[model samples]
Target chain A: MRIELAYFAWVRERMGTPGETVELPPAIADVAALLGWLAARDERGAATFADPHRIRAAIDGALAGPDAPLAGVREVALFPPVTGG
Target chain B: MIRVFVQAAPIDVGAEIDLHDAGGHGASASFIGRVRGDAGLTELFLEHHPAMTEAGLASLAHAAADRWKLGALTLIHRVGSMTPGETIVLVLASSRHRAEALAACEYLIDRLKTDVMLWKRESFADGRIAWVEEREDDRDRAARWE
Candidate 1:
């Protein structure tokens, strides 16, 4: 599946881009798996996903856990924990 | 009534308060968050998801209204570059009595810290830039509502 991936804050800085559209392998079925695949893809991904525990994800604009399925998700946002207000 | 706005322009607090007062509720409560100038901070930049940020704020406003029998509620958050002392966020809650409005105001601000899809980056006078880390206390405070 092809998905739009968004990076925010430090994640964006590390990834060197704000967002991108990428094709996913069949094995990348969840947020955790997606992170693992990206980490192995290159140095930028490696640095960004080095500490996946600190990262948070939103699948199709709704907060989702690592185990959340990405079967039909069109967009996924990855960022550090929010610090607003 | 509920109003949620996310903008890059400066927040007009007085104007917002005037509008909330027009609602004619017997009691009103508000929370205004300003960018702190601590440690020689120069600027505070807010990063957010274009669609998700507004949706998150609206959800928080709706949750506050449902939890408390509020007559009116307004939530505003500023994005983009901001200097110290500028208002970053504003929350206004009104109800027939004090307790409901006060609790709703507090609840909205508390939940915003952990729930909103907004991130703050700090720029120092010494040319240092860093993203603000989420505080454990913020998570603890949000958990209090649960």
Candidate 2:
């Protein structure tokens, strides 16, 4: 499946790009798996996902957990916790 | 009526209240968040999701309206780059009574800290730049409403 991946704040800075549309391997079925794949893809991803505990995500514009399924999701936004008021 | 805005433009507090006041409310409460020039900070940058940020604020507005007897509601958050003393966010809630208006205004601002898809980066005069981390206190505040 092909999906648009968005990175925010420092995540975007470390990723060296704001977002991208990438084709995913069929085995990557959840947010956690996708993170795993990305972390193994290259050095940048490795460093970004190194501390996944600090990472947060939104699947299709709604907040989602690590175990959230990406079956029919069009976009997945990854970032650190929000700090705004 | 509910108005939500996510823009890089400076927030005009007077104009926003004037428009919101047209609802003929008896009580109006608002919260304005400005970038503070703390520790020689020079600039503050706000980054947000193109679509989700507005949607999230709208959702919060509706939630407040649903929870209170609000006559009108407005929420605005600025994005991109901003300097010290620039308004970062404005939330207005008007109602028939002061109690409801106050509670709703507080609710919107508290939830905004944790619920919205916006991030803040602070740049110091000493050449240090860092993303503001989500505080435990903010989480605790948001959790109170739940």
Candidate 3:
């Protein structure tokens, strides 16, 4: 499936880009699998996605969890925890 | 009514209040977050996943509405670089009584601190910059609503 990956804050800084569209392998089942798959794609991903526990996600536009399915979704966001008033 | 704004413009506090202050609600409460100049802070850079941020704020508004019998609620958070004395965020809530308005306004601000997708990078006057971390205090505050 094809999906747009978005990074925000420090996650974007470490990734060297804000967002990108990429085609993925079919075996990637959910958000957790997608994170692991992307992290193995390159060194940058490996370094930034080193800790899944520290990472948070939003599937499409709603805050999602590890079990969120990526099927038929257009966008996925990854970032650190929020720190705003 | 739920209104969420994530923008680069300054929050017009009075105008925002007037937009929803159509009587009936006997009590209204607001919270403004400003850049603290006294903390050796020079600038604050706010970043977020655009669509998700708004959606998150709307969800927070909905949650607040559900928790309390809110008549009108507004959440406005600014993005981009901001200096000292600038408004960073605003949470305005109104209800027929003071207790609900106060509690809901406080709840919205407290939940927003940890639940939203916004992130802050602080730049000191000495040229040092750092990403603000999630605080234990914020988490504890949010948990109180449970």
DockQ metric for all predictions? 0.95, 0.92, 0.80
Cα error, candidate 1, residue B127 (Å): 0.9
What digit string (tens of lDDT, one per residue) describes model 1 on residues A1-85? Answer: 9999999999999999999999999889999999999999999999999888999999998999999988989999999999999
Q: Tens digits of per-residue lDDT for model 1 on B53-116?
A: 9999999899888988888998999999999999999999999899999999889989999999
**Per-residue alpha-carbon lDDT of model 3 for A37-68, expressed as tens digits?**
87899998998888888889888788899999
Q: Model 3, residue B67: displacement in angstroms?
A: 2.9
Off by more than 4 A, model 2: none
Q: What pairs collide in candidate 3?
A: none
- Give the clashing pairs for model 2: none
- What fraction of the reference interface contacts is present in each model, in order? 0.96, 0.91, 0.91
Question: For model 2, what is the alpha-carbon lDDT of residue A19?
Answer: 94
Cα distance off (Å), candidate 1, residue A72: 2.1
Candidate with better TM-score, 1 vs 3: 1
User: Residue B124's C-alpha lDDT in candidate 2?
Assistant: 95
